[model samples]
Target: MFTIRKATVADCDLINRLAQQSFPATYRDILSPEQIDYMMDWMYAPANIRKQMEAEGHVYLLAYNPGEQPVGYVSVQPEGANTFHLQKIYVLPSCQGQHCGRFLFEQAVSYIKSVHPAPCLMELNVNRHNKALHFYEHMGMRKLREGDFPIGNGYYMNDYIMGLDI
Candidate 1:
């Protein structure tokens, strides 16, 4: 079982900590260790998370296990009137098979539908080599496109842009 809650800026540190634990493990094999470290600071820094929440309009949700430990997080951002981007979703390695990822993905859809009840597109860019691509496909998302987008520090994300109309 899991509990999902909306996050405030004060929870940035918690989110960062969760990312520190899960993000590296999620990308350890697919990315270079240097890139993982760069992305951890780039995406999971408390200041960056706060900026995303306050300035960028990204709504974040945190998941907790039955014992009240934070195990995962998801964030969704409105890309356009009819498009929403699943910016991030990660579950702790220890919690992977327990449906926490599915719950977080569903909650993200629920949040999107709550805000834009009309038919809209939900998109997520997952690493082309990441195992979660299969999970996204299992969740009914189809590959819409793929790109190698540059981030910074000579790093690029080669990802599949998957989508589902909800």
Candidate 2:
């Protein structure tokens, strides 16, 4: 069985390592190497992740296998009164097709609903060309908007903002 729990500071290094391992496989074909490098440095650095963990508005969750090793993670933050942004959801490639992603997503949805109890909506952006877009759609997320998100240094993410109301 897999277990999910709140992440602690000690998990930062492991989280960063996971991001490094997963990000390239997911983005190397979708984004330029420079953009991927910039994003990794800007978003997954230990300091940035630790700060997010310390922030009241953000929540980071980890998924552990039966043996208690983390194999997946999700990061989320409040976007508005009743909406939350899924900043990232990553599962190690070795563990990818085993339903871990779905499990983590369900936990996130449940947590947000319990905390907000309002008309809670979960939102995330996916690259238009990403093969995983179908997975999100299959998981019941609808495309709410589409636009270009500027990431900096002349790089932009051409994405579709998908949402699921819980």
Q: Best candidate per lDDT, number?
A: 1
Q: How accurate is candidate 1 locally (lDDT)?
A: 0.97
Please give, for residues 27-58, the per-residue lDDT of candidate 1 as tens digits: 99999999999999999999999999999999
Q: Relative to the unseen true structure, what is the C-alpha lDDT of residue 112 in candidate 2, on a scale of 0 to 100?
A: 87
Cα-based lDDT for every prediction? 0.97, 0.87
Q: For model 1, what is the alpha-carbon lDDT of residue 140?
A: 99
Clashes of each: 0, 0
Q: How close to the true structure is residue 10 of candidate 2, measured as C-alpha lDDT?
A: 84
Query: lDDT tens string, model 2, 50-134?
Result: 8887874668889998889888898888887888998888888889998988988888888788788878889999999988799
Which pairs in model 1 have colliding backbones? none
Top model by TM-score, which number?
1
